[model samples]
Target chain A: MRALSKKWVALLGVLPALALVAFACGGEGEEGETFKIGVMESLTGPGETYGTVAVQAKQMAVDEINAGGGINGRMLELIIEDSKCNAQDAITAYNKLTDVDDVKIILGTSCSGAMLGAAPLAEEEGVILFSGLATNPDIANAGDYIFRTSLSDALLGVDTGNVLWADGIRNLVTITEATDYAEGVRRTTVEQFQKRGGQVVGEERYPSDTTDFRTQLTKLFNENPDALHVAAQAEFAGGTIIKQARELGYDGPIYGEVVAIGTTALEVAGEAATGTKAIITDLDPANAKGQEVLTNFRNRYDYVTLPWYLGSAYDNVYIAAECLKQTDDDQDADGFRDCLYGITWSGAIGDDYSFDQDGEVVGLANVVVEVLPLAERTQDNQGYRVLGSAPAE
Target chain B: MELPIIGDIIRLSRDPKDSLRLSRSNLEFWVNLLIISWAVAFAIWQGVGFAITVGTVFAIWAILSVSLNLVVGFTGLLSVAHIGFFGIGAYAMAILTSDAAYEQLRTEAIPTLGWPFFAALPVSVGVAGLVAVVVGIAFNRFRDDIYVLVSFGFAVIAFNVFLNWRSLTRGAFGIHEIERPAIGGWVFDGELEFLALVLVSLAVVILIAWFLMTSSFGRVLTAIREDEQATEVFGYQVTHYKLAIWVISAMMAGLAGGLFGSWTTFVDPNSFVLMESILLVSIVILGGLATIWGSLLGAMAFVLLEEGMRFLPFLPSEFVGQGRQVVLGILLVVLMLFRPQGLVGRYKL
Candidate 1:
């Protein structure tokens, strides 16, 4: 019995280590005709909807690349992992992609928390993790391997401030959803709002998934700030917070970042959602360039999973595939990484699309949209109104 | 294999001939204990080793369940608030062990707090116990049902504190990069090593609970549970006895929490929600409530149930991504309605 226990223990010990070794030392059984890129995104939880968009966009990019002779005659294959918008799960997925899948490049991570965790892991493991949705700058600094296509939380803060300024609201109250992503935007918005001569009323925070936001709403309403700044991801919490604020009898302008919930936020908040000032960075699916990509993506994927975020994702895959086309089929991690850094294009969002050393989208613009009469704004079958773009000076 | 006290516990906890012997009883217990210990040893010897992380989770949760069993099972008090207690220990130890990390993570400025490793453990346990003492006094008037509601309410309140107390707890983003514990020029840096510590601590806590369960006080607590009115009629001060056990259980929870915080090196409000407390109770109930061995077995089962499910990733990607808690919820319902006596019922049906 003792010997058996010892044997079991030894086997258990050796098994995990052995598996880890196999995973880390993955070899190409069929190395000939494919460049595999990992797409790690939150398919569910806080960022589920956005993740759907990212997934489709990534697929579109894959289809486009494969059609273009498959990254220099080698077809592009994407391995997808759903992060579930959590750090632990995101990290595990990240390790699996980099180690087991042996993906030379990554298109990834929508949730800020997921991005933050994954960014660090990617940096530690030296895998290039470029994301389209996570906005926090801490994510940018997590490692050299980390990069983002979305606007920085700091810049988003400034853009939101610009919207508030344009809308003629100078006194702002901030209520962040109390995650690193939301909190960073909240702080940045406050800094920019105050810097631009806006009077600050007060600030408060609530945990995510809170059903009763009455306590925080009561506080924000009592402050009577000219505008209320809601910093959150698009989800029930942000929308519900706005709805609760409205129910508390404050009908002021809502200056929101990405945290205004889904379009459902507008549906739930109703009249209160109107006059909401927001800075959006999503693709205008109706634009000639975006429409062409959207049509192609639809025909290719059988359905539009999420039309907006996926455009950029589609671009990312094509971008990586484009880079791979220039590299030797049997290059090392560093060589592949170098090729990834060198690619630039006129694709999905706009022309001269390129990444900086920090892996941030350079020369990007934020499109400011106002919550208007749903009838007037509803056009072209797209869910939102694209008023205009705001590029940072 | 004959020692009086050990023999008594085995006869009481692992009686194979009583027909109460669960499938794989002795073998399961010893194997689990051995595996758990081995996992911990590997983590300590290695570094936050994966298997060790699995083992640490079991040990911490098991010990936590045992501690909570004192309140939920013996005293018949219902408080989903133990997760809050778990949070307290985690937060307390984290604030101590990761003072530098806290300073970096928290936005607001606060005074630096640094304490020795041993000193932090006692402080965390003390704080959690003290809080439990205060909460127990206020909510002791209700029966278990209302008690659960009120306790759940308290857990929400604690969760709010964890989330909004940004200066202290860093709200929701989680305070990260905590330093490992240092003792005599050696740091407990690896998860396997950490797991070993967790197992030893879990064993010690369970042993203490075993001692308490068989003690005169344990009898009184059980008496109060089965018939509080009868105990009251018998001239026992039920409130005081209940409070004593609550405090003891809270200390145990705090100890487990400190170890947990140390191991994760990161703490967040999500870790302390009411559901976690409920999960702890489920483990205790599953392994036969009011028994120390039950708590240990339940904790092991709980961890295994959780980590084991990951082996078969059969769900569609969409369901797989967001379905963990949903599955847990269904399992809990099944366990509750079908196996009410629990896997190791105190008196098997």
Candidate 2:
């Protein structure tokens, strides 16, 4: 009975300790001495591959700014939160960043779903939610405070339509992943293609998690279109579709956007990816300044997947720093937003790219590129040889 | 009569008169009231930020857990389709209230009703409850592992329908700009205000659960749980009781989902996956089976523990997300070793 009582005493001591720990850990962080910017990204879920790279690039830029004597004498501090590439997690991450971290500026949310989810809250709260990679067209109207360095799918679709017509592909067959990004690209591309009097022979949409696309491809190929468009949200899906479509003996020229023709996608698809054309925003390999940025990134990270995303994410940090410098106050969201509207800054992504009235990036163009043959592919070149720019809509 | 850290909240007295009086049950009820009141008060004191956000989420999870506990804990029906009803309710809410446009199959527009919150939420609940009744009728014959497998299939099917039904749910694009609950001009837009609405709704759910559990119908459900054949022998029409409880539990989950849709102002297929159903089951099981108050405690602990992992000083910044998952797994494993019934659980699942 005495021993049991002693055990009970020990057990009874746990609740207050837990409460103490929670309260102790939640003590307010020291503020104002540094420029605190929050980053929300999918560090663990489906978007982790690009999200991790984006976070690294942002961190690299932050380090460089702090090393160059800290954003006007105050060091830059980033409070990072994982969105898990979903809406609810993004909202939670947004709350933590804005409420707990007391940050006025948030960068990221790699996935479009996460961006759309948190964009409403950030817009209503008057916080600057800037993204480097989210490309859904809905984000353009998400709010006044929403801005992205990434090109919207709306423009990509228009470029794709232009590319398809220019290449003399009159009848098109499309297979799209059922995601905001992929569907946005497919639907807008189809709309533009049809506007240009191009005929769509077949259209198919599979779920985001679909692995077997043979059935969808088989159905599409039955229509016997002149060209096929593969709209995929991730590298694996793009690669799988390309590889499987090739296996099914559809030899017509294949078309895709950035994700489907990305480095990882090319690697996954292997020789099957050859001759496939993609309209994507890419760093000009000939640009000395862009080359230097890529070199620095390679030296620091020792790897590169999506070089353009890295460059864009890097530019976002610099962009944020520029806005902060213009405002001279971390809390002045209106001043920062106005600064964004007025300023035209050049960085790793592109030169003289500024935000439009709707906060969409202006001045960057998507380039048409073709995947090189297996024998010609190199690690440095990442399996693609750049063609000239896509024709303007 | 005292019970360790839980104190007198869960004392298992052998006294026949004492058990009948259920004074300890009242103690548990009072403790739950105290905890919820403290949480609300603290969130208000802390102002509208992380605390209020977490508090709001806690109430929603508490509602889901308490309702799930009715089916899983009280009636011995292991449901993996609770989140499906949640999705239906959320979609119903979003589809009914929002004026968001979905371009239907490339040519025309799918219509949005744009009803107010008061009208939309009840319809959402009714829709979910109706679905539950249909599913419950179909699933009434199965038990144990078979029931679990079949219910899991239901969850998968529901998720697919949400994902592929582009005209209605807009596929993976999601329904956005869901309005906050409003009565005329008083919109529950502020975080604090929304949290209060959620807390009040949770209180109503708890009361309903309490009333149901304390009634003679609840005793019959418990009897059915203990021995279905014997309960049938005692002339208790076991299938009817099970179906009734299932519908009630599903309706409560639907209500939670409606609030979830409004609070986040967004609903997507990703939020209602099969894994979420398993998570709900874990929450109910971890909090202790057959105890309504245990669901409240379970949700509080789960939410706080997840949020608290963000504040772990030792974890490297890069590994924070992955590290949180790992640490949570380890802690849950340790907890299970110590108390297989769960933190305050009475049954071992």
Candidate 3:
């Protein structure tokens, strides 16, 4: 009788653990509670500068939404987590938000690798994870629970290669950085560029943190190709390419992907990167609506955040809040996941986001931008004018 | 709490004495593994990519962790270089299975000479084993703490090779798209079936490992661990025993390397970095040292704890990306401070 009583005591003690599971599973939106949206961005790392502005942009959107009486009269709360651009770290941030906070909609994540780990976990747990800057096409159909805002590495590769080929630049020097994302750009660009009949004369891969590109620049100097294609989304690499190309006295046209977002390229490369060609999805330099967004974001965030990809992170929270407002029922991870496909709001980028079959934005066009002379560029309430509207079409 | 649902008839007749160890009418790990294998086969039949990914990871880790136990727990020979051996194994299989973008690498790097996956698997592991033997012979002279530092050096050196060896490893980009086994015109397809195969392979390796640990040589190792000087007095060659165990451990790491390649379908310096070796040590520490059963139990516990923790966000953010490592660090410190014996504690051979 005594032993049986002790066993009962132990079993009763374990009830608390079972209760935890119960607690974790509970907490769907009640009749009165505000719908919570999670903003998971890298608050630290190489992307922290962008993340800082993104947080402001996110706040601007949320505050405006709340001021307008919010969705269905329930105020939307923005819960933010800093993923720090690491996968395991992002998972930790995600769990803290999803498991305990019970936020159904996750607005994340900056890094592709971090998103890869967090996305699967989110899908498994039925948390509808929407990423802002994850550009890998493989991730779009990764799981039914995953969705993202940016175009793929493959798409930009095709776009850039075809554009260069059309410009009659056959001789090219391709330099890539040593990271999965950078290497991915390298692989796709090389393949696409070759397909477009562009001759890659000199090919070399630089270290991710290389400051001096004199050797590679010198190699390129000798080849003197028609165009120099640098495949890296990093600023330091972009800056080095600009500075080194000028130093090595190779006066060829330069083109790169999102590497132009960093102002360091202009600062370091001086007038060299001005004429450098870059691809983007949005331009706020001359467009009225775009200029207004860039100014408000800068004022609210205390920094200018103008990249189209960065705005999407801000817009992720707004879309989720809007979707939750439209739906009457709340016990719906799959429904909410489905609801995300039904967005049509003219937010940050001045475009109504229409999610396609893969939950990617349809007609998401990439614009070719030329870096202008610093003297000619106008500094406004936002920042500097980066690109003109595709040479006035 | 859950009783084994299946019975193991083969284990009983083949080894009547061993049968006494397990409860009658209850399945042991082997039987459980057999059932799991069937389930995995079904999963693979349904889809190859997912199954194979999980299988490759499980099998690699299982072999890697258990083989590590031979040195860390049973032999009391602390090494942080098991990851180095893992890298060697992976590089070997990668170069063998794939057509050589085949460039020259650092010191530990081998050309693999375009061997088939099967041929590369053993040869690579053998290379690891040989390296372990040579290293063991040299390091055997040092007693206690010095041996650990030396092993640590080996792991670091191995990492350097993977990191700086540009032509072969492509530096940080790593070796990608190593082909999987194509049996009967069906490329493994990398599904749950592959994961099951890896799991089955893990279970089988554990069983074989159990047999090895139970053998007479294992008894000598136990004696040496308890007191090397005393074992020498008892007419046993302690150095030879150490070398043999190290060789086996190295080979197992090699096998794990092959399995990891199949799962990720990619191998890089990152996969076999020294941190992985540290994780293997932590697995034994948390589960229990010197206990074969503990190694298996430890792996399951590690996986479960890691996955479970992902569900709890109330835990400190310091416990985030580095949280698992932080928790393991704290747990290890506490374990060493108090229950130095580990969770299951040490066991007899």
Better of 2 and 3 by DockQ: 2
Best by TM-score: 2
| Weakest lDDT window of 10 consecutive positions for candidate 1 chain A | A18-27
- DockQ score of each predicted structure, in the order shown: 0.14, 0.38, 0.10
Candidate 1 docking band: incorrect
**Quick one: ranking by TM-score, best first?**
2, 1, 3
lDDT of 1 by residue, A107-197 (tens): 8887766776566546655777878777765555566777766777777777777677666778778887867678767776677767778
**Winning candidate number (DockQ):** 2
For candidate 3, write residues B128-161 as lDDT tens digits: 8888888878888876788889988899888777
Residue B152 of model 3, lDDT score: 89
Fraction of native A-B contacts kept, per candidate: 0.15, 0.39, 0.06
**Cα lDDT, model 1, residue A177:** 81
- Better structure of 1 and 2 per DockQ: 2
**Residue A64, model 3, lDDT:** 80
How do the residues B55-76 of candidate 2 rate in per-residue lDDT, one tens digit apiece?
8889999999999999999999
lDDT for each residue of candidate 3 in A1-393, tens digit (9 for 90 to 100): 345334433432332353356354444544256667777776665455555556666777778888999788877776667666644356556755764456677877766655655665676568887876777544655567788777777677777777777677888888877554566566666667788677888988765557878888788768879988887757767867887887777777888876653565556666677677776566444456556666677675455544576577666767777678767434466778778777776666656657777667664667677777767654452113334322211
Off by over 4 Å in 1: A1-47, A51-108, A115-130, A204-225, A240-252, A270-272, A284-308, A312-361, A379-383, A391-393, B1-49, B99-119, B184-186, B323-337, B347-349
- With candidate 1 superimposed using the best TM-score fit, by how many Å does residue A20's alpha carbon deviate from the native? 19
lDDT of each: 0.67, 0.84, 0.64
Per-residue alpha-carbon lDDT of model 1 for B1-349, expressed as tens digits? Answer: 1122244346657665672344223333443454355445434433343455566677788888888888877677766888888889888887876655333432333445666566788888999999989987987777767887898898899988988887777676665544467787887764456667888998788788878888899899989888899999999998889888888888888888787766655566656767667777778787666666666666765665454333223444334445655665565575555446554455331
